[model samples]
Target: MTKEENEKRLAYLKSIVARLPEKPGSYQFYDDEHTIIYVGKAKSLKSRVSSYFHTEVDRFKTKVLVSKIHDISYTVVNTEEDALLLENSLIKKYNPRYNVLLKDGKTYPSICITNEPFPRIFKTRTINKKWGTYYGPYSHAASMYAVLDLINKLYKPRTCRQPMTKEGVKAGKYQTCLEYHIKNCLGPCVARQSFEDYQKNIAQAREILKGNTRQILRDMRAEMEQLAEELRFEEAEEVKRKYLLIDSFVSKSEVVSHTIDNVDVFSITNDEKVAYVNYIHVSNGSINQSFTFEYKKRLNETEQELLQLGIIEMRERFNSHSKEIVVPFEPDMELENVVFTVPQRGDKKTLLDLSLMNGKQYKFDRLKQAEKLNPEQKQVRLMKELQEKLGLPKLPYQIECFDNSNISGTDAVAACVVFKSMKPSKKDYKKYNIKTVVGPDDYASMKEVVHRRYSRLLEEEQPLPDLIIADGGKGQMGVIREVIQDELNLDIPIAGLAKNDRHRTNELLYGFPPMSVQLKTDSELFHVLTQIQDEVHRFAITFHREKRSKRALESELDSIKGIGPKTRDGLLNALKSVKKISEANLDTLTDLIGAAKAQIVYDYFHPENTTGES
Candidate 1:
């Protein structure tokens, strides 16, 4: 905008801000298009809105946001807590561009115990508040199914759609269906099970859904014992089966502590673009519910802010009245009755760790899925990661790694392996036979190869590799830098791959003085670095072996006077070995080569006798 226009816009914004009240509220920022671009909650609406237009608003994104604002709107609230809730609601409603986006808008399935004459329990994605009590919006369907399966086994609730009332059962308006015959239901509609008994089972199922299984287990055990005392063996055996089922279910749950009931545990993991939060709700010593979700960052929100928003959103969604929340760190917001915990050790710490693991796993799985769709995304990410780690000027699009191979100075060879876009470029691979450097002088060999590789690229007017890697440790890294930077006067970044005592790729060394670059052993960056080292090593070793083999062949057969390359090749092909050629008689050699070549060969190996004289 022009200077006068900018002044006018700022003045207009300041005038609107001046009229704002200093009460807790949610505010929305509108852009030139008159659309809500950002939504935020603050304790003082006037102060928060005014702060955005201040000269010291240094955050680049916030500054850009201020520039785009053509109008402002807000809703005053009685307290900060109300402001937080209102902010969340407005963000969900309008989905402003500058608001943290809830990425996983998935409506997960929940176990609903229908509020019918005979409550039917099943999994549902849609919630109807009149439908008895909902156990969860289970993030994992298998968990919800397990709960329903246990409920089915224990209660044998009616699956029929017909409303079962006591009057209908007495009037014979409903009949027992196949579910009754299959022993899946107790036929509450047909009056086979009393209303009171069915209601009692429903109550027990509710307790189990709430993860209050101890009371239900004790009741089932007592009922089973009573049946046994009455000599009702079949009924007692059935109750025993249910009692054991509930017991097994309880044993499988992650039991924290009986004292840590109704507490919420949360942990967060984030990158530049998104943040993930994992929530675990504990009830009666068991993890009753767990979920991991992501937030698409807008305006570069801090992890604390994202986490605070997540906490409020989750609590409201789950209808949780959890007074105590276990967090990795205290979030930037507060709830009236809630106490935040950052535990050092104990059950809460374990829960916090578990939540962190889940959040990280969720982020990893999401990245994996995205990479599977576009495989190049992973390569680009790894390249950027390496670039960032090394503080390189650019992405390591083309990496060249050098390795030397020899058997105690014999057949010395060096190989250069090139990786373009983090993949091996086999055609670009170069092999160098040791010319200037004799013996197992690895440093000299690396220096020679590095000088040769880049000098040729410069002479040919071709692009130099973004990075050059040495297959040996610190000594080799110094040799490369001296050759590439000092002698050749090129500015390529050089790194070294160091092997452990076991000759396994162990660490990466880079920069002057060569500090070890810390890389996780299992990470892709480590894998790719190791791949380059191994490839170069393999290429160098194979070249050395081939050179040695040719020399060995020349020593045996090339020394023969009449045996040219073709003659020697023919003999080797026919006889399969030098030993076999030596063992062959003149007649056999004549058939393979000519009689004259055969005589020379026979005479060379069998100098004791003249071949034709016999």
Candidate 2:
């Protein structure tokens, strides 16, 4: 393709990529003549496929791969596993010229039952037809081994490779190994434990491998009870140990129960050219699997695409059957009966966020692996973190915070403070006098002030801020939302900063009805929020105090026993203020208000000179 053609092609690719669904699926990259060059899977098809043109990818191979692209296609799947299997199958079928081979990628071990007469149960990377049963293609060998170890501990399955036969045992040709000496095995080689009994144990072990450990627990409990009733203390004790082992393992694995029995959570985080995706699997409210991996965006794929692909890849790689997938976005894929959710503020949101954090951490670590620290790195890092943390679509280059203050139903006022790039924007700070509400009605005062502020901005056609923060709880936040959204018809994001009884910022509230968002108090975002809240509160209080002071200054002279309003006005008009009046000479005051009242006013204004506290 020519340079101009490539530019046009990139733009066209971007448009098509933008329409990719966020669901678990696989995608294909094609050259100019529509020859398939690469095949990939994604949890979000749109996010993944669209990312190719995100930036000028640094890797040479990626640059070539993206440059060769002309058209793209995708296959939507119900789960991540389906995407992975599809990606594998499609890659093999077409032999995409530019596709990168995942080396020994599917070599992870699985628990296998050998086809021998006395089947040996163990973890193996090889899948042979001679293996009686294969339990998993576990994402990690440790996971498969953990299950195998648990099975051996509970059921005492023989670990020996010695082939057992009735004739060999009858002829005394087989002897018990060290496993029997250590009581880890039941000596099936010597026939101390019959094949029927050992086979029964193996059957139960198979159930655990199949994720039906619950049935085994119930059966073990009943056996324990029966043994205890029969006065078989040793057998009952053994059953009790196995039951507790399974129960503890199960209980420790639970994550959340708000959804259903099975769920897969996918989250994505990315840098300029690379993306990291994290996957979490929850079964029976327990986290059964979690992983984070990297993806190189050949065409500048977005975080959305990377995360979607990660979900598909992780699910497919782990062979997960979860139908309900939790994500931070709607991948826009139509998978039958599979639900994708974007939770706001609940347990599900928490889990999704946890996965997001993992992705972010993984990306951070990867960046650090090659990171060269510069002066602006921290600032850039903070801005990006804030963008992710607040779920803001854009970086918070401009933030506006508001507060309302009243002094004993007097001097009703509000203040708006500006923060630009996490620093105070003093020149943009604004103060307002309460105009619409009577008494100490903070809600009305806030509504009036916000309406006036934004109304002027709208009339002037000024840019709205990236974020608006209200220094109050839901009630006050509702008023701001009403003014900013309902009245102005603007689509600005707003959050509430609430204080505890001690007047300290303790929670950040967001969403329609406003739910408290969890945050670590020591985090930089929390600190920034606290700073914004404090600045607005301080500004409002300062303005309120100044107004009250002015009123008090004007009224001090009027409080004199002999001074009336007319006299006080005359003195104030001449002297400008009580402070000025205090500095005025006796002759000046007497000239402004008559001698007797002027003396009273002068005495009140200069109480210190009159022997009383001023």
Candidate 3:
């Protein structure tokens, strides 16, 4: 924690760097405890790793980073770019706290066409070469749905099960659905459209996916003009309408900056331990989109790894469009077939500088805010207030609140919510089901829930909550304390919300004589506790309701054979709801839920089993 200590660590790291080979490779940094703090890649391991110790760098941030270095390790690669790619791969896999990570761990929709005689387009999240063509990682589900809607409207691609045959199109012996009737589908199954015509439409949809919007519009305009010349005024009007739709879609994209067209700007901010990378995407001389990535760690290798990941992830996430990405630092990242630039001087350079400035300002603002509160002050103030009011020992920085909810004891669930420094730590929220207790035994249920909650923490060697709050009076407080002492073997402070006859926040309840402490409604401490209690109650109740609904649906389906967890999940996801599955006929169910499971469903719904029996 001191400069002298840091210098000793840096000296050791410098010795390792001096011994490293001067070839392309990756490097890793470790703390005094030998924990890998950060990972990075460089064209030359020796040079890049040694640069961190350079005394000429006057930046405090750089100095601080260097001060944290305890040890260095490296692996030589074939090339600098190869090293970059390897570093990114390592960062993603390990998620080293210091590396700037790209991808918010959210899946975006991609359009996939199954490679069949008659390819069918579907909205999906996973894309592979096995699937014909994938268009996007569209920003959201709504945008993907909109694109699908537009594609259906403009192209009317087939959405049918009838297989394309050598003799002719095999028309399924069924009436065309509303999709076909509404002109959203070409009705190829009913033989209303020729295979050649459907294929041509598919080609056009693919072109749109390729982002040739201007060319597509131009082609549409020419067709409209041609139709008008041929006296087909109605056809010309349809073309104009389609053009307008495309125009509207394009216009919704936000413009970021006017000076640069088709460029992406990258910036990063770090607070010793955590780093955030922000990307500003510009298209057609306007900023269209922006994104940020948060990473943990304080190592040079980790920083470089983040830089590499930022580029690859942005490219993959924005692969639908053609654009160049600009980064302030030259990342030795290898992106096959993708162009990246670090402009030295020009309009692009100015944009890059602006982005760097933004990153620095963001770091400064965050640091200023962090310095104002100081975690100790925030924690001490909240805890001291709680202790004084509740009359317990020490400040309770780690507080846990519990709540239970159910409908007539059905799907009864209890939730334990944790707060640190007066801020909700959602990551620590734990839920439990009232399995042993039968109906509305709130006291018994509270004891069972608290025992289950803390027992796990004790087993895991995790930190225990400083104070525990229950959503009831003396009974709840007693149950909470009994569980902590008997089950957890720890003496933790316990209290309960003493609600009035109207079931409103009235007073706080504590042990033995059941002393009640009144709280002023306007007090910050009171408001904070109330907020935490309410949130836990709401969360527990919502979870209970969902569990109840799922349980009801699962119970109904348990009778069906060939329906294990995997198949049931597929059925539930494909059919969406139980009502839909129950109503679907054999063939419709088979197509979606698979043949084996479909038969089981048919047998369950219709005991006669005429539809599914061989």
- Cα distance off (Å), candidate 1, residue 169: 5.1
**Tens digits of per-residue lDDT for model 3, 414-528:** 8888988788999988888788999988888888888887787888888888888888788788777777877668988788787888989877777666787777867667888
The sequence of per-residue lDDT tens digits that candidate 2 reaches over residues 1-614 is 58898789888988788787889888998987889998877778887776667675576667778888889888888887578668877866787776533232346666788776567888777877565777666655666677877887887877787777778877889888888999998887888888788778888877666565566788899999999999999989978998998887666554466344578888877666566677887765556666676665554555555555566556666677778888888874445567888889888888998888877876666556553555346556666777776688898888898888996667899999998877788999999998778898888888888899899998999888988988888988888899888888988888888888998888888888898887877886789788888888899998988899878866676566866777767766776777787788788877876788767766766677887558
Which residue pairs show collisions in model 1?
none
Q: Rank the candidates by TM-score, best first.
A: 1, 2, 3
Q: What ranges in model 2 sit over 4 Å off?
A: 1-36, 40-88, 92-149, 163-173, 206-212, 229-233, 364-614
User: Distance (Å) between predicted and true CA of 402, model 2?
Assistant: 38
The model with the greater lDDT, 1 or 3, is 1
The runs of at least 3 residues in candidate 3 whose Cα sits more than 4 Å from the true structure, single-residue gaps closed, are: 1-20, 27-39, 48-79, 90-106, 159-175, 255-261, 269-273, 278-294, 298-305, 316-323, 328-614
lDDT of 3 at 455: 80
* Native RMSD of candidate 3 (Å): 21.5
Tell me each candidate's TM-score. 0.90, 0.48, 0.46
- Highest lDDT among the candidates is held by which one? 1
